[model samples]
Target: MSATRSAPVFAINHMVTPALRPQAFFQLARSLGLQDVEIRNDLAGNAIVDGTPAADIRAQAAETGVKIATINALQRFNEWTPEREKEAIELADYARDAGAAALVLVPVNDGTGRQDGERQNNLRKALTALLPVLNERGLKGFVEPLGFEICSLRSKREAVEAIEAIGGQDTFRIVHDTFHHHLAGEPELFPQWTGLVHISGVTDVAVSIGDMRDSHRVLVNAQDRLGNIAQIRKLLAEGYTGLFSFEPFAEEVHQLENPAAALSQSIVLIKSQLQA
Candidate 1:
């Protein structure tokens, strides 16, 4: 596909540099001329998981001139329960105090609760329950539909429908992940409702799409099998004006001796392709 549009802005996810401190990660983003980033709750010895105060996170972002686009996720969010509600409230409060604009809502991916009507009902229930918490904190809920076969929410269409059912159009938006979009086999871009776009590539030619896992995710390049460029171009052309956060989960990315340099190369590759 020939894309004549200007390159989209890129953001760095903490997954791309899990070993770095939040301060260091923010600096790396700034060094790359990027102003946005996504912090995660899963990284051990990291900010959120390490008990770092929200004020400190806010201070760090201010010091480095970086915006905390979101707190990477609240897991298994589709299963509505008192425990999940508590977690959502706490995470939302933390995100607001930490100056993050949103929280990512990830669904259960363990193969349970995925029955057709059951999944939609659970999604709507969760969104209904979480709406007030997010609204009170003035934050957006970025619902990210995981593409795994076992994932409770695999299709963006289902996610969007659930969001609409809950009347959450104002407080929620979907995450259009290139990797997940390919795996879900969904054709619609839904750019109007996409608040964020995650860009990752799968370059392993031998791995079947059904067998692809997070360990196989890598940065976009010539070897990308997920059509990151085409998806990005389509989203951009169709009115998705949001950050494309890099979320490579492969150990190779984490083990890089110079992650900033490696990430810069990937950014260059993506930009070249988008502006081609």
Candidate 2:
């Protein structure tokens, strides 16, 4: 077997809409020396061409030489009924044809009065219903546990349990988000089940973890990066061989003069810290 590399591969979501085109996105990643990218389908104007012909996305990826590592998300999948489930299946097909390796699934946050047992049962049902579609399409489902109080799954531990219960680990994996991990008060080594890790920093003056919000998320080197370095180091030490994608959703980062430069700098900082 080949020796494992310590340097983490990096990618960025299409968050800086007006500033970066798909071509420019690839060029920037190439300049920064990255080989993979995760495209966010919700970014205004620069949304990954999902509903359009897959050939368009294929051409862009081919022209840019950047493989589509994963598609940003298929939200609220856990609560999806048959109609919604069918739609998600179609989306999975689209992702595969677009040359994506996986689809990220975010649990539903619908404020229902279901008990904890009901919630877990719903999650299990959803996974059982969707796993066949994902497996058939040769696509992996990256289940991301959101940390917001209202969000259903708040940690990779919960996601792992659900995956184990649903028996989808063969076709589903976890996505560890630094921002979510901090907000959820989850440990860094929780990345053991991770297939993809999202890197973002959180800044808040609150004394406790519950006070942090997703809006506080910024680039990796921001002030609230308490365990960013150590967490990534631990993941590396544990033999994680996946891409670390930048997923800052803050308005400030979206308005930056050169988002790619900021991302490049963040990658360099992460590399230096990890090497040390």
Candidate 3:
């Protein structure tokens, strides 16, 4: 892929305030000259449901030229019971109509401290059940294996295994997150699974992976990149041809005096780093 061929898509999760209206979010992306945005469903006031009429989202996309790269998440879909399964299917349909290219699925962080075998088995079952729904919708299911110590699936290896077990490699792909990859203590794991990348940086290692919340994520730079550039280089070298989205979750970014300028600067910085 050319340096700009796989132009990075950015997520509004780091820039838009949850309280802001969707129109304002798209406008922000437009001002940044961004053509893609990832929408997180659980953000307060941003709970996008099936009831959220499609016309509104479609209009925003049309006006801004910002396409929905992926719906933020369908959490623990791997462990959903029959009732939850229906709810997820409804959300998948909503995402399709909203013009989203994929649904990002984060594995369940079941707090009960189950044994490793049991957790893996539940994950396989969940992915198996969710695959057909995704296939029917023609939507890619981007599985994001979070790396917090408590998270059930912490690496791409496990995600690949789960997808393979469920025969979902055709419809499902991995979401390689820089922050999560660093937290997972696996710096060079991207080559095995080529898919979407969620990029961000963290500064503090003293902060335990479990204790470090999303607020700590920031843009990549020498002072605080936490090896994100190295990670991206590895992915590019490995022939990844998918989107790389900035998904910082920091309140500082959202509260910036000029978010568009910040986003533009961040994108430039990312481009420079990738080219370097």
RMSD of each: 2.2, 2.4, 2.8
| CA deviation > 4 Å runs, candidate 2 | 1-4, 16-19, 49-51, 188-190, 204-208
lDDT of 3 by residue, 1-276 (tens): 334233444555523455556777777877876677787777654647324576678777778788888888888765669986987887798888888888988876755434688777877888888888988898998888887777777778877888898788788888888888877786556554656888777776677666776789876655564677777777776667677777777777667777677667777877787776
Which pairs of residues clash in candidate 3, taking residues 3 or more apart in a chain or in different chains? 78-126
On lDDT, the candidate that comes out on top is 1
Q: Write model 2 residue lDDT over 237-274, tens digit each, in one string.
A: 77788888888777888788877688777877888878
Displacement of residue 164 (Cα, Å) in model 3 is: 1.3
Candidate models: Cα lDDT each:
0.93, 0.76, 0.74
Which prediction has more favorable lDDT, 2 or 3?
2
229-252: candidate 1 lDDT, tens digit per residue: 899988888877889999999999
Cα error, candidate 3, residue 146 (Å): 0.7
Q: Give the range of the ten consecutive residues with the poorest summed lDDT in model 2.
A: 43-52
Clashing pairs in 2: none
Candidate 3: RMSD over Cα atoms? 2.8
Give TM-scores for every candidate, taking all chains together and pairing residue i with residue i.
0.97, 0.91, 0.88
Residue 157 lDDT, candidate 2, scale 0-100? 75
Candidate 3, residue 63: the lDDT equals 80
Task: Give the winner by TM-score.
Answer: 1
